[model samples]
Target: MIFDEFDPKEDKIFRLIDNEGQVLNASLMPDLDDEIIVKAYKEMLFARVADEMAVSYQRQGRMYTYPPNMGQEAIAVAAGLVIRHEDWLVPVFRELGTWLAKGVSLKEIFLYYMGNEAGSNFKNAHHVLPFSIPIASQVQHAVGIGYSIKLKKIDEVAFTFVGDGGTSEGDFSEALNFAGVWQVPVVFTIQNNQYAISVPVRSQTKSINLAIKSYAFGIPGIKVDGNDFFAMFLAYKEALEYARAGNGSVLIEALTYRKGSHTTSDDPTKYRDKGEETEWAKADPIIRLKKYMDHKGIWKEDETALIEQYRTEVDKQFEEAEHFTPYQLEDVFQHTYVDMPDDLRRQKLEYEQFLTWKENRK
Candidate 1:
C-alpha cells in the first residue's frame, strides 16, 4: 500500500526529495548505483550550464530565440538516465538536457540555433528525432515510431515530451487514443511546468491533472515531482519497462515550473507572480540535487570542479560553433528538397541576380 495512492485522478504528488533536500519516499526510490547517481548529477550541471549560456547567447545576438529549461534540470536529466540506448526520444525545443543525455553535442545545438540547417542533421545518431518546435505534434510521431517497433517485434519504447498547453491540442489526444487502441510501445511524457507560454495550467483545463487524460484512453496515468530526480527516474523507468513489456502505453506528467521566459521572444514577468518565483526558487532542482549529493559525501569540492569542467567544454563548443560560416542564401534552397523544383531553382537564380546587381551598383 506504500504507492497505492498513485492514481492519476488523485492530486497526490510523488516526490522523493523534499524542497529541503530530504527524502520523502525512500520506498519508491529507484535502484541505482553510486556512479550512476554521480553521473546524473554531472549531466544535470552540464545541462544547466548550457541553458544559461544559451540565453546569454540569444541576448548577445549570437544565437536565435529558444526556450530555456532552467528549473527543470532534474526532469530532463532523469529522462536521459531512464531510457536505454535502444529507446527513442522525441523532444520539444526546451529539452536540451534530454538531447545532451542522449549524445547530442552542444556544438550541434549551437549550429542549429545559429540558423544553419545542417544542425538538424544527425547522420549517425540512433532513434532520436530532431528537436521539434511545433507544440503537441511530436506525440503522434512518437506513437507512429512505436507502432513500427511493435510491428518489427523489436524491443524498443518511444518517449515523447509535451507541455501543459500541448495536452489541449487534438494531436495529443489522438496520440493517446492510438496508443491505447494498438497498445504501442510508447511513453507520452508531459512537462507540466506550470505554464505554457504565460498560460497557467488552471487556465488550460479543469481536469484533476494532466495525467488523468491517460485514463480516458484506457491506460495508466502517473504524476511525479518533476523537480525530484529520483522520483522522475523511477516514474520514467517503470513507464518504459511497462510499455516494452507489451502492456498498455503510459502517460507521465512531471509537475515543475518554468523558471524563465517561455523563450527569448516572450516575457513571464508580465503575468507571473513575483512571490511565486521566490517559492519555486526554494525548490530549485539543481540545488536540491547538489545538497543531497553533498550530504551523501559524493560531491567533490562541492562540485566546483565538475562545474568548471563543463563550463570549459561549453565555452569551447560555443566558440567553435560561432566560427562556423554564417547561413548562406543557397543553404535555404538546398534544405527544402534534394532535387530543387523548377520554381524553386528559378527563384534562387532570381535572388542571386538581384544580389549581383546590388553589388554592381555599390
Candidate 2:
C-alpha cells in the first residue's frame, strides 16, 4: 500500500505528477480511464470558474464574504471522485469542488453565504453536512457519524476536511482519539494550504508534518502533493478502500498553497509575500492537470469557449440566489428551540415593533 511505503513520519510526500504535469511516480498513477481523467479536469475547471465568480459577487456586494478554493481544487476533486454516494461528507467551508460533486447547487451555496439559514438545508445533497464555519468542529461530527455507521453495520465511510491550523484545536485531537479507539471508518483530510488565516504551517506545529498526527491515533497517514490531481486521487482511493475494509480511519495531509486571500474580507498581501506566491503559482492544480491532459493528447477542446460557458452558468446560479426570497425575521430565532422561551418571544416582538415603526417613518 502507498501508506506502508510513504510513512508520514519520514516526511515523504506521495506525488504522481510534477508541477509541469510530468509523471514523476508512474507506478503510483491511478488506473483512471482517459475519459474519466478528462471529465475530472473539466470538473476542476468548472469549480475554479465558480469560485472566481463567487469572489467577484462578494466584491460587488451581491454576496456576503466568501472563501476561495483556488489552488486547493485537486484535493477536493480527488476525494469527490473517490467518495461513494453512501459516504458522508463533513466539510469545513473550503471544499467547493467536492460540494459541487456531491450535488450542492451553486444557488444553495450562495443562499447560505447570504445569511439565509435555508441554504444550510442541502436537500439534494445526500449524506453531506452543512458547510462548517468553526475550525475543526466538523471533525468531531464526522467521527460521530462514523461511529453510528459502525454500530448500524453500514458500508459507509465518513470523510472530513480541515485546514492545517485546525489540527491545533482541542476537538481535532479529541475526535481522532475516539476514532482510533472505535476503529471507525473515517477519512480525515488536512488541507495544509500553508496558512490558517495569517498563521503559517510552521507556527501551527513543531512536528515535521500534519499527517504524522495520525501516529498518535494509531491510524495510517500519508503526506500527498495536493496540487497533483492524480496524486490526490490515488491517495483517496487507497484510503477509502483501507477504511472500507474495516481497518480504521486514515489521515491525509494535502500539501497545497492557498493562492488567494483567506476570504473576501481578508488581505493575502499583508501576510504572504509576492515572491512566495509566484513560486506557488507555478504548481497551481488547474495548470498541472491541464498540462497533463494536453501532454496525453486529450485536451484539444476550445478552452476559452469552455471557460466562458462555465462563467455564464455560474452567473445564472448567482442570479437565481440573488433573486431568491429575502431572509425572514422569524427564521433567525424560531429554529433555536422547539418552544420559544418567553424572553425570546418578547425580543422577537420588540424587533417586529421596531421594524413596523421604521417602516411607518419611511
Candidate 3:
C-alpha cells in the first residue's frame, strides 16, 4: 500500500508529478480515464477563477473577510473527486473546490460570508457540515459522524480537513484517539499549507512531519505533495479503501503552500516573503494540471473564453448573494440550542429593542 511504502514517520513524501507537470513516477500515476482528467482540470480552473473572484469581491467590500484557497486547490479537488454523495465532508473555512464538487453553489458560499445564515443552509448538498471556524473542533465532529456510521453499519466514510496548525489542538488529538480506538471509517486530512495565518509549520510542531502524529493514535498516515493532484488522488483513493474495509481511519498530510493571504483582512506581505511566494507559485496545482493536460492533448478548451465565462458566472453568483435577504436577528441565537436559553432569549430581545430605538431616532 502507498501508506506502508511512504511512511510518514520516515518523513518520506509521496509525489507523482513535478512542478513542470512531468510525471516523476509513471508507475505511481493513477489510471484515470482521459475524460476524468479533463474534468479534474476544468474543476481546478473553475476553482481558481472563483477563488480569485472571491478575493476580489472581498477587497471591494462586497463580502466579509474571506479565506482564499489559492494554492491549496489540488487537495480539495482530489478529495472532491474521491468523495461520494453519501460521504460526509467536515471542512474548515477553506476547501472551496471540494464544496463545489459536492454540489454546493457559489451563491451559497458567498451568502455565508455575507453574514446570511441561509448560506450555511446548503439545502441541496448532502452530508456536508457547515464550515467550522474554530480551530480543530470539526475534527471531533467528523469522528462522531464516523462512529455513528459504524454503529448503523453504513458504508459511508467521513472525510475531515484541518490546517497544519490545527494538529496541535487538543480536539485533534482527542478525535484521532477515539477514531483509532473505535476503528471508524474516517479519513483525516491535514492541509499542511506551511502556515496557520502568521505562524509557520515549524512553529506549529516539532515532529518530523504532521502526518507522523497519526502514529501516536495507531492509525496509518501518509505525507503527500499536495500540489500534485495525482498523488493526492491516489492517497485519498487508498485511504478510502483502507477505511471502508473496516480497518481504521487514515490521516493524510497534504504538503502545500497557501499563496494567498490568511484572509482578506490580513496582508500576507507582512509575514510572507515575495521570493517564497514566487517559488511556491511555480508549483501551482492549476498550472501543473493544465501543463499535464497540455502534454496529453486533452486540454482543448479556449483559455481566454473559458476564463471570461467563469468570471461572468462567478460575478452573477456574487450579485445574487449580495442581494440576498438581510440577516435576521434571531438567526444568531436560534441555532445554538434546540430550545433557546433564557439568557440568549433576553439578549436577542435586547438587540431587537436597541435596533428599534436606533431606528426611531432616524
Q: Please, what is the TM-score per model? A: 0.95, 0.98, 0.97
Off by over 4 Å in 3: none
Tens digits of lDDT, candidate 3, 199-253 = 9988888899999998999999999999999999999999999988999899999
What are the per-residue Cα lDDT tens digits for candidate 2 across 1-362?
89999998899999988888999978778899999998898999999899988898899988889999999999989999999899999999889889888988988999998988878988799999999999899999999999999999989999999999899999999999999999999999999999999999888899999999999989999999999999899899999999999999999999999999899999989888999999999999999999998898988789899999999999898888888898889988899899999999999999999999999998
Model 1 TM-score is 0.95
Residue 161 in candidate 3 has what lDDT? 97
Clashing pairs in 2: none
User: Runs in model 1 with CA error above 4 Å?
Assistant: 1-5, 325-328
Question: What clash count does candidate 3 reach?
Answer: 0
Q: In candidate 2, how many Å is residue 134 off?
A: 1.1
lDDT tens digits, residue span 1-362, model 1: 21246887677778888887787777777778878888888888888888898899999999998789899999888888878778899988877777877777888888888887767776555788988888899999998998999999999899889999999999999999999999999988899999989889999999999888888998888888899999888888888878878996888889999998999999898989999999999988888887887778776655677678878899899999899777789888987798999999999999999999999999
Ranking by TM-score: 2, 3, 1
Report the C-alpha displacement of residue 174, candidate 2, in angstroms: 0.2
Clashing pairs in 1: none
Error of 2 at 111 (Å): 0.5
Evaluated at residue 48, the lDDT of candidate 1 is 88
